[model samples]
Target chain A: MKHLVLGGVRSGKSQFAERWIAEQRKQIVYIATSQVWDGSMAERIAKHQSYRPDHWHTIEEPITLADTLKKVASEQPESGVIVECCSLWLTNLLCAENEAQLTQEREQFLAVLENYPLPVILVSAEVGLGIMPINALARRYGDEIGVLNQRMAQICDQVTLVTAGLPMTLKATQGK
Target chain B: MKHLVLGGVRSGKSQFAERWIAEQRKQIVYIATSQVWDGSMAERIAKHQSYRPDHWHTIEEPITLADTLKKVASEQPESGVIVECCSLWLTNLLCAENEAQLTQEREQFLAVLENYPLPVILVSAEVGLGIMPINALARRYGDEIGVLNQRMAQICDQVTLVTAGLPMTLKATQGK
Candidate 1:
C-alpha cells in the first residue's frame, strides 16, 4: 500500500508517518530528502533525527530519489519505506538548476511509485493556501509543489493531510 | 451552524462555502473581506465578484469584521452569512500596524462567532504548510494565521480543509 501524507510546517506529518509505517509491521527504511542549507535547517534535521529510532535504516538521499527507492525495494522487499518529505526534494532539484534532471527525476519517481512493491509512505507540504509570494522563485515553487501534490495524491492508495498533529484523510482505497 | 473552511491558494474554498451556504436555504449574505491593495488583488476581487450570484447580498468589510458580523447576525437572523476569508482580514490588520486593534478584533470575531444566531461559514487560507519565508513579516503572518486557524477550528461546529477542489472534514460535531 502506498500513502501520501501532506501537512504544513510543524503540522506533525513526520510523527504521523512514523506511527503509520510502524503499524505496517515491516522493517522500516526512512529516506531523508532534506538538505541543510542553513543553521535552522541543520537544527531541524538534527531534531528529526533524534525523534527517529536508531535501529531504523536511514538513507539520506537529497536527489536521485527514484534510484534509491528502487534499490531499497529490490534489496529489502519486506521493508516499509518512508520518504520523509518531497517538498525538500523538489527544492533541491530546483536549486540545482538542472531542468532536464528535475523533469527526469520527477517523472521517474512517479513511474516507480505507481507500481512499487513495498508499503511506502511519502510526506509533502501543502503550501499553496497563502497569499502568492512576491518573489518569482517562491511563486514558481508554490506552483510546482501544488501540481506535484495533486499527481502524488492520485497515485497513492491513501492520502492524508495533517494539521495540529491530527490526521485528516483526503483519499483512501479500501482493502488496499 | 458555524463552519470554518480552510484551503490553500486556488483550493476552491470559496466555491465550497457558497455551495454549503446555498444548501442552508437561507438568504445568502456574502461578506467579502478582500481589499484592493494592488492591480492583481483588484483583478482577483473582480473575478470573485463575477462568480457570485447577482441575488446574494454582498458586503465588503476588510477590517471591522466582528462589528459587521454582529450587525449581520442581529439584523438578519434568518440569513446565512459567509465570511469569504479571514486571511485577508488578518493581512489588513497586520499591515495597519495596530497591535491592540488586531487583538481586539480577532477576540471579538471569535466571541461573536461562537454563539452567532445565523448559519455562518468562515473561509481562511491554510498558509503554514510551506517553507518558512525569509521575510520577517511573512514569517509573522505564517505564525499568526496558524494560531488563528487552530482557534477557529476549535470554535467551529465543522472544520474542513479544501485541496484541489475537494473538501476534507478535519473536525465535525455530530448532529450539529
Candidate 2:
C-alpha cells in the first residue's frame, strides 16, 4: 500500500507517519532526506532523530531517492519504507541549480514509485496553500511542490492532509 | 449554513465558493474584501469582477466585516453572502499598523459568524501550509491566519480546503 502524507510545518506529519509505519511493519526502513545546511536545520535533524526508535534502519540520502527506494525494497522485502519527506529533497535539487538533474530525478522517482511492492509511506509538505512568496525561488518551489503533490496523490493508494495535528483524508482506495 | 472555503493563491477557491453559494440561494451578495494597493491587485480584482454574475449584489468592504454582515442579514434576510476572502482583509489591517483594530475586528467577526443567519460562505487563504517565511511580518501573518482558521473552523458548519481546483471537506456538520 502506497500512502502519501502531506502537511504544513510542525503539523505533526512526521509523528503521524512514524506511528503509521510502525503499524504496517515491524522492521521499518526510515529514509531521511534532509541535509543540515545551518544551525537551525542541524537542530531540527537532531530533534527528529531523538524521537525515532533505535531499531529502525535510517538512511540519509539528500538525492538519488529513487535508487534508495529500490535498494530498500529489494534488500528488505519484509520491511516497510517511510520517506520522511520529499520537500527537503526537492529543495536540495532546486538549490543545486541543475535543471536537467531536477527534471530527470523527479521523473525517475515517480516512475519508481508507480509499482513498488511494499507498504511505503511518503511524506511531503503541502506548500501551495499559501500566498505567493515575493522571492522567485520560493515561488518556483511552491509550483514544483504543488505539481509533485498532485502527481503523487494520483499514484498513492491514500492521500492525507494534516492540519493542526489532525488528519484529513483527501483520497482513499478500497482495501488499503 | 456558515461555510469557510480555504485554499492557496489561484487554487480556484473563489470559483468554488461562488458555485456553492449559487446552489444554496438565488439572491447572492458578494462581499469582496480586497483593497486595491497596486496595479496587480487592481487587475486581479477587475478579473474577479468580470467573472461574477452581474445580478449578484457586490459590496467592497475592506474592514468592519462584522457590521457589514449584520447589515446584509438585516436588510436582505433572503440573500446569501460570500466574503471573497479574509486573508486580504488581514493584510489591510496589518498594513494599517493598527494592532487594536486587528484584534477587535477579528474578535467581532468571529462573534458575528458564530450565529449568523442566512447562508454565508467565507473565503480565506490556507497560508499555514507552507514553510516559515523569512520576513517577520510574513511569519506573523501566517501565525495570525493559522489561529484565525482554527477558530473559524470551530464555528463554521462546514470547512472545505481547495487545492488544484479540487474541494476537500475538512469538517462538516450533519445538516450542512
Compare the candidates by DockQ and give the number of the best one: 2
- Predicted candidate 1 versus true structure: per-residue lDDT over A144-176, tens digit per residue: 999999999999999998885568888999625
lDDT of 2 by residue, B1-176 (tens): 99999988666688889999999999999998998888867977998899889999999999989999999999999999999889888888888899999999999999999989889999998877555768999998998888998999999989998864558989999644
The Cα local distance difference test for each model comes to 0.88, 0.89
Give the TM-score comparing model 1 with the true structure, all chains together. Answer: 0.61
Task: Score residue B7 of candidate 1 by CA lDDT.
Answer: 85
Q: Record all residue pairs in model 2 with backbone atoms less than 3 Å apart, i.e. clashing.
A: none
lDDT of 1 by residue, B35-147 (tens): 88789989998998898889999999989999999898788778899998899999999999999999999999989987888888999987787667798798778878877
Model 1's CAPRI class is incorrect
The DockQ of each candidate is 0.22, 0.24
Q: Pick the candidate with the highest TM-score.
A: 2
RMSD of each: 6.3, 6.0
TM-score of chain A of each: 0.98, 0.98
